[model samples]
Target: MRELPEIRFLTSGDVTGAEKSTAETAVRSALAGAQGTVTAIRVTLSVVADPALPRPALAQAIVDVDGRRLRAQAAAPALPEAIELLRDRLSVRAAYLRAS
Candidate 1:
């Protein structure tokens, strides 16, 4: 079995343990399609202090596959929504890269 790539999580504001864990799991699951090509993954999540913003939660990720890099970002009113959006974006990008 191929080993999973190293995943690093960075957070700002009131990020929770569950959010980080869920983000990690989502990234790992998405990378399954890309598998051995991945070298590392970095996930960043943050919550905006301002309450006026329509989308206060932000999530982004950078995936290093071999020597190539793939990136995705999303914003939502809730952290979980941003995480899921980022995960989906990453998954699509990974699959596209894997194909070519």
Candidate 2:
């Protein structure tokens, strides 16, 4: 069996848990954990802040595999949720990629 492909997490500003996008070793990790048959993957995160209102951070990950593409985004009270949601989306895609 082949190992999981890499996974990349890109961020704009200080996202609580995750540092700057591609900080530390995200690029390396993503390149290592991408199990999905995603021929290509794009992870982009933009920080949207409202002073009047405290809103949860939003996260989105877009995966391009062959002619099929999958996009996942989740708005959670915390940054972790956003990450998990995005991962779940990718996981589903990974499964599909592995199966087919």
Candidate 3:
């Protein structure tokens, strides 16, 4: 089967940042590695200040596959950690989506 189509995400909304490429690459990597057919996918991310933490903000990812959306929100001590959490979360979501 063909690899699944995926739209990755990142801190930046547009496709011009590490996070964007990171998100997209992860999905594409996951789907491609599994040899699954891709229908459609979209991932969006936003980094905003955290009102409660007195920090820059948090990283939130909203992913859409076909007609379903998977949201992963995490507040880590750092952006890298947040991305890691998001990756794990998205991975689980992708697995779930692929199964059913």
Candidate 4:
């Protein structure tokens, strides 16, 4: 499969380089299996200000597949976990979009 053109990562200082790589890998892996003209891919990682929340870390992805937009989001106490969740969710959604 041809490599994705560019993956834009939107994050704050709280997000580390390792976490960005992890998120990028996860998104690429998920999108690799998708069947379409992937025009753009954007992943956002953020930490909620409220520490009281159970899952402060957030991962979100927006993929432009054949001009259609598909989105997936996940939250966890840790960035890695959130990225994992995002990958799985995005994979499923992508597959469904392809099927339909």
Best by TM-score: 4
- Work out how many backbone clashes candidate 3 has: 8
lDDT of 3: 0.55
What lDDT score belongs to each candidate, Candidate 1 first?
0.89, 0.55, 0.55, 0.91
TM of each candidate vs. truth: 0.93, 0.56, 0.55, 0.94
> Could you arrange the candidates by TM-score from highest to lowest?
4, 1, 2, 3
lDDT of 1 by residue, 6-86 (tens): 788889989999999999888888777784477778999999889999999999999888889999999999999999999
Q: Residue 23 CA error for candidate 4 (Å)?
A: 0.4
Residue lDDT tens for model 2, 1-100: 3433355656765464443343213322333444445465566554566545454566676666656776767666555556566566656655666677
Candidate 1: residue 1 lDDT (0-100) = 35
Worst 10 residues of 3 by lDDT: 7-16
Task: Select the stronger candidate by lDDT from 1 and 2.
Answer: 1
The residue ranges of model 1 lying beyond 4 angstroms of the native Cα positions read: none
Task: Give candidate 2's TM-score.
Answer: 0.56
Superposed Cα deviation of residue 54, candidate 3 (Å): 7.4
Query: What is the C-alpha lDDT profile of model 3 across 10-91, one tens digit per residue?
Result: 3442224665666566555544433244455655455455556643434555655565666666556555556567677767
For lDDT, the strongest prediction is 4
